[model samples]
Target chain A: MSELDIGILALQGDVAENFMSTMAAMNELGIDGSVSQVKTPDQISAVDGLIIPGGESTMIGQLSMVNGAMNALKEKIGSGMPVLGICAGMILLAKNSKDRVVGSTKQPLLDVLDVEIERNSFGRQKDSFEAEVSLDAMDIPSFQGVFIRAPAVLRTGSGVETLGKFNEKIIAVKQGNILATSFHPELTRDVSLHKQFVKMVADSKS
Target chain B: MIPLSGDLPKSKGIKSESVDSINVTKGTSTLKRGFAHMLKNGVVMDVTTVEQAQIAEEAGAVSVMVLDKLPSDVRKAGGVARTASIRIIQDIMDSVTIPVMAKCRIGHVYEAKVLAEANVDMVDESEVLTPADENHHIWKWDFTTPFVNGARSLAEALRRIEEGAAMIRTKGEPGTGNVAEAVLHIKKVNDELRTIKSIYDSGDKQGLVSIAREFKVSLDLVEETAKIGRMPVVNFAAGGIATPADAAYLMSLGCDGIFVGSGIFKAEDAMERARAVVLATTFWEDADAVKEAQKMINEKQSILGLDVNNLELRMQDRGGSA
Candidate 1:
């Protein structure tokens, strides 16, 4: 496999966690690659894959929108650059989203994915939990999921593939090159989900 | 035994995954600690009203800490400052999409319980408010909601952590608008962390134990911190951080993030200062970006700072013994 450059969107939230996990996954998989925190459009464009770590969806989208990286991200993801959006990242990738408590928000979004998201479906930090979620597509039996002010997919378009669910709520989905999850994959010791994304990036480069 | 070659405590100490024990469990140490990770490298602003909360969110704060009044106002009132009104906290919660937080007095477990019931994203057991218990802080592990506590030294920080505080902030002189105390507190923590790391690296088990006793924390916690060379949990600079450069300076000192108490709302240009702090914090390593953010409030400075030495009440001293 050729050397790959993977970027963790660094505008806010868990960028370092994702970078460390992805690098660990690459090392475990024996993939020659590099992972770094990326903030600007050029940094986003240079990577073979990108992971938008879990954070405040409104803040991430608003900041990214103001700085022009949101448009660049849409363009790249539209053209099949492999990307993973976790929690807030999932909120950004969806076409529509509404808070479970507050109803609707005017926050910026990347409307590339055809789905609707329910923000904080499990409730606030007090309601955050650890759950065992099984994603058949990732080829892992079950993974420990950390949900913190997590978002759940309320609707999925025909193109979207349901990857996993917890409590009858959709938590993971993939459509073409875009993959998203409402749980943080970087927070756990398990690297299976990251390995899957790295595999996608490697395949794209090949 | 100190596992010198073992995995760093970054992922250690946190309970390993057990399907039967952890599945669907709220308030697990893992979940509480991971919640703090989400706010790293982001600014959390203190807001009194819905408008200020909205301004904070629009300014790109990762979260807003709802207080009954700004610290400066609380200082002037010269009365017991308690938890914020539930109505105001709920109202702010409704107005913004970001996480909403509020402060409760130290060892005020019932106040914390009320905050948890109110569904505030996080509760701060803060010194800014009058201490409810002079002898002890709340044992935070009992609650499902996470708590952030303030510390002026490594011993204080470790003691709080021992009692289940998931996050730690410097107990700078709140309402003073002075950054001196905050800087001193964080630097003190850093220096002690370095000392512990060097001792552990030297394989001095006796020294480690003595240091642990000195810190009033477990040897295991000290060893874990020594291995990681930083706080076991995310440590942020808080209290009296009035300027964007203050925020940037704290970030450069290796703090995870910042919390602005009276800084934004009491400033000459509250909105612009809020925006600037967020910008400076997010791009702390970029000189050009910090310069641009600093230029926003060109002539308007932050709140005129009160010299911390002149303050009658040293909030940092509250609830220190326990």
Candidate 2:
């Protein structure tokens, strides 16, 4: 059996952090896997799983749209590829999103996740902070949620299962194979989230 | 491709997967340093107006650094280079969805305050701006807003970090339209970091302590930096990067990102040059792709390269005192 290949959407933003964290998670899980940054649809297609790491959503969306990776990403996620979208990635994966300050945006979105997001819901860089989040079902006790100009889930469709919330705001959720977080799990030592996503990919491969 | 999941917008109650409410801790080290991490591997363009800010956003800049004038213009229009007007920074913030950063003259507390109160995503204690105080840099711990400072060498970089800078960029001679200085700065930092990493690997604490004393920083700073084998914060290549190749070369040198000062809007083909630089920075390892990006811009439209040798006032030398 071939080792699972997971691609981090390299359009823009913290691709290296995701690459390192995901690699560590794969190793910790005792799973043979490789992680690479994918900026093109062809690269996206080659990966068994995907992670759209946090960065500027507008930049990521614009690059993804112009490079034709947006549609490719949607196609892959729709096909039930296990995926983890973090922070700005959460904003891109939503069905609809508007900024807390600038109001609505017209940038291209993957729009596969059944949620409406509000950008900078926690405020600007000054308001960015960390939290001790607990993922009840995943047994991720005391997971540090690093929210940096992060979004908040305003609404989740009936199919969406909320995995975590902070200050009454929906911050992490899952709908089948699609997992999204409003905080940066890759920014810290906790690779449990990545490990869980990798396990999902490993299970799907089997 | 369309979304494959249920289009049913039924708002169901959460499945109680959330364990319990969490405590929010603001302005911690992770929050400060992690903010800049999001900008890694991207281009941050400097813009003076809302239009330029929009152009930067459209050109795929990770963020727009709001400046009162391009570094080139700042040089030509010399005098006291102060922080940009609050109104302009607010306007650029309103015009673009990307995070907005602005420069405060090094050691200018009030200017930094105004930029912070204006709610910019980050502040750059910039060398391009005339130093408000040559003897002192801002003690960044006073502000919750993250700050990026320019450094020409590893000691400067570590000093700024010790002073609470969340990110660092090479103090490439701004406005010169020459990347030579930026190249040299990053190379120096890389070489020093390598030295420290090896010194730490050899289990030489005394060497590290002396290194910290030389940097005028804390021993912990040097130890942690040596352990990490890189800048404690995201270090970008900044100032004078006026072309796609310039941006790519800096990225290849291991700078976390690219910051183009007068590189974009000063050119005849600002938008094309901006996009080309973004492409090159994002795919620096791909020589073929970088070549294709270079083809997007005409050399004739490029910013006139300035000979650093002829420049009398080097912006990089400012604010290095104390």
Candidate 3:
């Protein structure tokens, strides 16, 4: 694949770190891609792919709405533009997110992915854990998964394929050109996930 | 030079010295009054960006934690420690006059030192979402800067305090979005200490030893630790703090303050949430404030799936050869 133009959502969350990891991933794959921060709707149009970093789901949703990027993101996802959502990003892409714990605050989801997410299903911070799972579709075996206040894929539409699972919970999933993971693959040194995402973008472009 | 006397002649220079001394005395008194004033009324706000920092100040938060990320880094490799950059820290500091704090890895003294130079008032040694530091505890005495270390149990909390920590925080675990763990931890510590004091009056060494063994620690050690500072030293409650009620819950547990990372900025109404948290901590006894705080928590965004076991520190070379 030729050099790909990748953009990371910079409205909130781990914007800079995601950009660095994405660039590192591209370098590992020998793919010369230019990664930049995309906050405006216009910037979305210039990128071949986008990575929504992990953060507080509600804030990202509210900020995106306030900044006028919510609608643009929905439109982009609708157009089958390749996008990767990690952790909070995964919650935002889900059709609906159910907070397992009792609380009153609600998040405005993008509803791009046809899935239901159970927020903080793995318990609190002390209960946070990790596992290795195989993404058979991507031919990646046993990648280390990080789950911080991560959401779980409770249910998925027929179009979505479960890519990886840990402790019988779905952690990675993909639908058409859109991909979402409950764990943060970018947080790790492993770049295979990013490579897979970049390939998806390349395939979509073709 | 003329010899100095107890009572010098009323020369212009001498008179000027007397005036300067009086002014210094007045200045010290004024500073003490100001600190007391802040303790009575100062508020703390949770913020992320520089814009949010400015808004926090306007909303009456006494201090702000310069967090670009929330408590969910447990599942990832490059945790929140590596996530929050220097530029972001500088930006938030530039935007506000109130004390700005940032999260750092537990043993990453280098990061803490850098933050100290940046002039952050305090560093929250929190393990909320970031990867845990290697086993060696932070040597607080090594740094001239002050820090607030997170402790889950009384023993751990007291140890951090013993290490000369400027402040203490109950580690309820980050990203849980629940305050029950924090509540339980604080209650257990306070209750245990009470029990120890009553037993000490009876001169029951065997009873004390048994109790300490049951707790899997030493009572004398804990007492020694407490002696490093005054009892109930600057303790704050953190982790899973999502609403004003949560902040109030911590205060009720005898915490001096609360640290709300994602609760405010992540809420639908950031400004209102910030104000509510401040109110909750201040008027903790007011049922109305508690109700208001409970209503401010975000139910939908509370789900966090951070995996702590997989977050073991992997030594990766950033630029140099391993």
Candidate 4:
């Protein structure tokens, strides 16, 4: 396969870390793909795969909408471009955000995934935790999940497949080329999830 | 007589394919620490408007602090410098993807509570504003949102930490755009830490206890800080940092990060200067990188910095002096 280009939505939240982790994953996979930050539509359109990193969901959604990146992202995801959404990114990609305390938050959402998410499902900012997520389906032994004001999958559509969970709560979900995880995989030393996502990107490119 | 490693506290239920229950803490302090770690070597810019926040984000700021008035302007206005308007804070929060931090008057728990309710990434019990309480600071431990406070000495930093400040920044003379006071403050804290370290190294437990009594913080926290030889929480340099060189100097002095206020937006070329400051901060050790960042800005375009001595009010003097 030709070199795959991976782009991290640079609108906000751990963009540099995601880029670094993706590069590490590409190197581990022995793929010659380059990882760069993408904030413009032109940059988004050029990537073989994309990542929306964990950050403030409200800010990311509002910024993307104002700059037209959200529309561009929706089109790319619709065209089957592989993407990974972590934490706030996960909340943004979901069809609706159901805050455990506020019910449905009115923040801007991409509505790309047919899943209901509970924002800050674990608790407040002080309630965040690090846990080992079971990703048996991905053939990984165990991925250390970093949850920080992270969201959880309250419900998944029939087409969506659950890939991982933490404390009996859904933390990762997938629908075709789109993948969303509540925990921040990039924050950790482990790049296996990034490798898995890169593999998906490589497969799609072929 | 000792138990096996598997018998360690909460390690018995090691479950696969699930969040390790053992890693959960009573509070999300670990997660907050992780967040602060990610911000190392980054710049947190103070911005007033949504447009300013956008520019900060585009310029690669790790976070943008929302304030109604610049420190200089607050000093000049001479009124109660409270937190930014909630609507403005919300707008800025919505405008940028980076973390948005807002300041509350020292010891104003209600103001901090309102900010937390607004869902800011962090709250700063800042001395730059008029103190709501003369003798005490807000009990940060009561809040779920992590807090950052300013300090001039190790005692101040540890007190804030004991009260649960997730981060610390030197309380330089705000609005001056002069880095001298910040330098002095950070140096004082550093010198105190070095002194404590020597006491610990010499196995002078009595001396350590005396130091703890002087600081008025717990012995355990003091010992932990002494062992680590630094603030337990992330420490960023703030107050009067105007230029990229100023930022680089502070970072080189061992600050984890920097906070630029009135320095960027107050300049003639906000965008270029903001970007340059971020660059210099991220690459403080590299002289070439700092020089490149310096070249990005024209000195004439920089904010006219005020002399620290001439400032009528010293923010560092606010709150508990000890």
Best by lDDT: 1
**Model 4 docking grade:** incorrect
Candidate 2 vs candidate 3, DockQ winner = 2
Ranking by lDDT: 1, 2, 4, 3
Off by over 4 Å in 1: B1-22, B298-301
Q: Model 3: residues >4 Å from true position, as ranges?
A: A1-206, B1-43, B73-80, B129-133, B203-221, B224-231, B292-322
lDDT of 4 by residue, B181-249 (tens): 999989998999899988888889999999999999889878878876877777889999999999999
Candidate 3, residue A39: lDDT: 69
Q: Work out how many backbone clashes candidate 2 has.
A: 0
lDDT minimum window of 10 residues, candidate 1 chain A: A58-67
| Ranking of all candidate structures by their DockQ, best first | 1, 2, 4, 3
User: Candidate 3's residue-wise lDDT over B1-322, tens digit each?
Assistant: 1000111123111111122122111111111111111222234555657888877765556567765565543324253454267788778765554456776666677777787667565666656434345555566555434566777666666566444455566676555555666787678677766776667666677776776565554576444333333233445676667677777777777666677765566566777777667667655766775687657655564444333334344211110010
Binned by DockQ into CAPRI classes (incorrect, acceptable, medium, high), candidate 1 is: medium
Reference-based TM-score, model 3 = 0.47
- Across residues B177-245, which tens digit of lDDT does each residue of candidate 2 receive? 899999999999999999999999999999999999898988987888898798878889997899889
| Per-residue lDDT of model 1, residues B1-322, tens digit only | 1111222234322333444454476676777778888898899999999999999999999999999989999889989999999999999988788899899999998999999899988889999999999899988877778889999999999899888888899998898889999999999999998999999999999999999898888998888889788888888999889888889999999888999999999987989889899989988998888888888764456788798888888888998877
Those runs of model 2 whose alpha carbons end farther than 4 Å from true positions after fitting are: B1-22
Give the higher-TM-score candidate: 1 or 3: 1
Best by TM-score: 1
Q: At residue A111, what lDDT does model 3 achieve?
A: 87
Model 4 reaches what TM-score against the true structure? 0.68
- Interface RMSD, model 4, angstroms: 8.2
Residue B111 displacement (Å), model 2: 1.0
The residue pairs in collision within model 1 are none
